[model samples]
Target: MNGLCLVTGANGHLGNTLVRALLGQGHRVRAGVRDIGNHAPFAGLDCELVYAELLDSSALDKALEGVQVLFQVAAVFKHWARNPEAEIVEPNLVGTRRVLEAASRAGVQRVVYVSSVAAVGHDGTALDETHWNTESENAYYKSKILSEQAAWQCAEALGLNMVSVLPSAMVGPNAGSLTDTMGFLQTVRQRQMPFDPGFRFNFVDVRDVADGMIRAAEKGRAGQRYILANVRSSPLSDLIAAANTHTPGYRQPVSAPRWLLLGVAWLQERWARCVGKPAQLLLSQVRLFHNVAQEYDITKAKNELGFNPRSPEVALQQAFAYLYRQAHQPYEDLPQAAVQTVSSSRA
Candidate 1:
């Protein structure tokens, strides 16, 4: 498997990590990004950087040519949009279809579509790889579910070998603005936990997820979805505690009931609508947060793809260290013992 591999969304958090992982495995990687001019991240790396947008068919075809494996990681992820049909659904679903079609035409041997756990519908405490999130009204979650379905449909229609890896809440170094995982962490670090969102969900290190994506491409079954999630779920309070260990002067997070949070979310959504901006608190987010009783099952991934993720504590520490450095703090000021603990948990 030392052939050329194309990773879409190459500048993204997961995609950036995947590009590095693939390079480490001695594979020739073509980093597919929307802007080839933005080459700072891939600097000094032995990989080709190419411009490829998900909505652009010509770019997709060009990127797929001579590629043995395709890692479809580009998606429009956001809680709210001015026009979700154009900004979110069209790009995710239609762009996914375009990539699959181009891959089939180019005779790519394997494709690892990077989906999310949001695609897996939750039935109380029964959410797993088998569940499909068909009931979600959230644009981001719907895009993931429909885009994945489209990928499968294209694979079946063209007889292509495609596998999907669904990752849960991802945390680690290099989390960009695409998701709120790090933003929530920063909020806690700033002692800004005005109210507890009452959310508990699984989390996995982005590096572990990148490794899992490669493993899925190598060994996952065609048309099957593997959950690249953590074995444990961390609540907001627990995450704050974990951060407090590394962050100095961190305040413990406060709590609020689910009903009050829901009402606040509703008001926030209304305010966002009035101001023509995405809401920090959306009803869909609140609903999803409320549906986290059981952790997502990863036994299938472990048994089949040899996926074993580190604990959330390691991810939290890594994130804290990265953020601390990003804040222009001196390296000597960082918690050395905590950093060593995080480095040891990278297996």
Candidate 2:
């Protein structure tokens, strides 16, 4: 479980952070990427890089060879695709099965599978790991549920030790260009969202989630599922306030009725269809917001794996700074002195 660990999706938000965490712990990591040439971020690190596409099972055997533990983090994360079966469903289900099979062939000892909170359903109340997302029609949600189920079934059949960690929306400094958590903040920052649903959801720092996953691999029970997230769910208004605290004059959305939100989603979806792209806000997403707020209980993870997550507000501040830095924009509200204080304390 310690030597030559393989991490799939090496370039993604969570994957990149997990790779850094593993390297920091003096572990020899083989970064499994779809394209080795695209791994400029891991250039200076002394980790082996291999081309591994989950969709192409033949290549996975070589990638998993000589690896002790496997961190399966690669998957297609999209809400809506013109061809859901090809773009979303197949990639998650088939690719996950292929990875599990390859891991078995390579004689891997343990696997840390990355799932999502979307895969776990609720009954108009707080949810835990026991709840399965059975009634969800969202493609992304369905993919996660099916993929996680397949992983467990395959692991049991193959007798490979496996633990699944379901992370809520992740936000932190190292979020890549396409993270949904960061994208949600951007839509709010850019004044794109005209209204708020007033609903709340669990959010966790990307770094914390990465550490939690590693802890799961090290200390978690095999065949068990852990939920990695902040202790409390923050409302939409709380998120906006956190952003505004760091960036002055941030626009806050007014509360909108459910019908109005649905209408807006419909229009946006229609426009996206005409433009041959997915809508920024889909009807399914709107409907989810209309439902009661979702609270995640991470007590199991805390008690078992000792997984501790930072405050969502602190994570949001880091994300704001990251986005500003990436865009080469000066942080007028976050003064240099304050930035130095926060950075030093964080370090």
- The CA lDDT at 263 in model 1 is 93
Candidate 2 deviant stretches above 4 angstroms: 329-347
Clash-forming residue pairs, model 2: none
lDDT of 2 by residue, 29-62 (tens): 8888776665455645667777788977767887
Q: Which stretches of candidate 1 lie over 4 Å from their true place?
A: 123-126, 176-178, 329-347
TM-score of 2: 0.91
lDDT of 1 by residue, 220-284 (tens): 99889999887667777677777777766655556777788789888988888799987877778
- Enumerate clash totals for all models, in the order shown: 2, 0
Ten residues in sequence with the least summed lDDT for candidate 1: 338-347
Q: TM-score per candidate, in order?
A: 0.90, 0.91
